[model samples]
Target: MGSFEFLLDGIVRAFELIVTLNPYILSITGVSIKVSGTATLLAAMTAIPLAFALSFVQFRGRHAVITLVNTGMGLPPVFVGLFVFVMLVPAGPLGFLNRIFTPEAMIIAQYILITPIITGITLSAIKAVPEPIIETVYTLGGREKDVVLTTLLEARFGVITAVLAGLGRALAEVGAILIVGGNIAYTGSVGGIGEGLSYTRTLTTAITSETSKGDISTSIALGIILIAIYLFVNVAAGFFRRQD
Candidate 1:
């Protein structure tokens, strides 16, 4: 087939898989959402509070903590994967949890990877809150707690963008989850598509595996889904920013 024809065929096949709910494709998409979604939530919880604390509190080593968070924002995903793999290995320090090669391991790795990104962005957002706005809260009989709350409300949109950014990073990530999650699937059949329910086979890893096995149609389907999700997240973030 000609290149255009081949590309057309792939797009048609991808849409078919999606509309038909191809078992393998659905399973991979599910894993991607569950793992990345959970990690993003966990990261947001931790990062938001830390960001707030860093913004409001004057304490020793504050600069050090900010520096560390900044550094962590750029951590290499593959190196994080290796570190988590080691920590979860049979003889490793946390091996007793026996979470290696599991969805939980993937969550942990992704959480570590995205936490700093969220925290750093959130911190910046909080810092950007106008000093006059904070002072206005205080001028209106607001206490320290009120000031913090008011600042947080003002920065809410930016913080939401930070969380979305982390979610996007988590969803697109493959290296860390691949090492820790193992991308395994159980033997099974679904909708007569001869697909197995995935344990750790997220969309990104599934695309890699499917393409390597010459399942170009499946790969294309997954790639389309992944891009669609990333786009949605970014668009949502932009909307919230505009509202802010």
Candidate 2:
């Protein structure tokens, strides 16, 4: 009975915190969205062309490249973080960029983590496109670009699912972003209002912090929001699936 009452109290407090727009929670949520969205967009931009090339072009080492991409799908995030940190270190060749421990660094890490996923899934989608569709477009005297575009369009549903899968991976990730971004929250002025921002303190990070500190109410609230976001993504994916 005591445990049940405690759980009920925590739930009520969590809802209160969410409804009241707690700054720490809101800030973490904002950072998560920004980092995840930017990573997804950048990954898509790069992956789409790579997917097309892999699907339609024949060249030396093509099989090797595909194999590498497939392997990247299961990459360990902590290892990626360690590798990137080495390259971005002060003495490293490209260290002039000074991208470490910033939102930009977090985005970069996420891009690397998610790009392989995007590429692998996109390759699957493109390959799933009917061969007759490709040949039909080609036989109609369509340009190579036109045929590729048509193939992509025909596989649009699968492509969108691939993107969602990449996003799901990105949003749920922790290790890479935590390592590169340092999980430090920043405080400063935002449009004349005091605001806190963190390059790495995503919803997951916030939940971790809250749980460690025994802030069950806030942790529960953040968990709810995280679940809501995942549900929304799944719902959106379902809509696109139906469209395809």
Judging by lDDT against the true structure, name the best candidate: 1
After superposition on all C-alphas, the RMSD of every candidate to the true structure, in Å, is 1.6, 3.1
Range of the 10 consecutive residues with the lowest summed lDDT in candidate 1: 187-196
After the best TM-score superposition of candidate 1, give how far the Cα of residue 49 lies from its true spot, in angstroms.
0.5
Q: Each candidate: what lDDT?
A: 0.91, 0.83
| Candidate 2 runs further than 4 Å off | 187-199, 240-244
TM-score (all chains, Cα) for each model: 0.94, 0.90
Off by over 4 Å in 1: 235-244
Task: Write down the TM-score for model 2.
Answer: 0.90
Model 2, residue 126: distance off in Å is 1.1
Which pairs of residues have clashing backbones in candidate 2? Answer: none
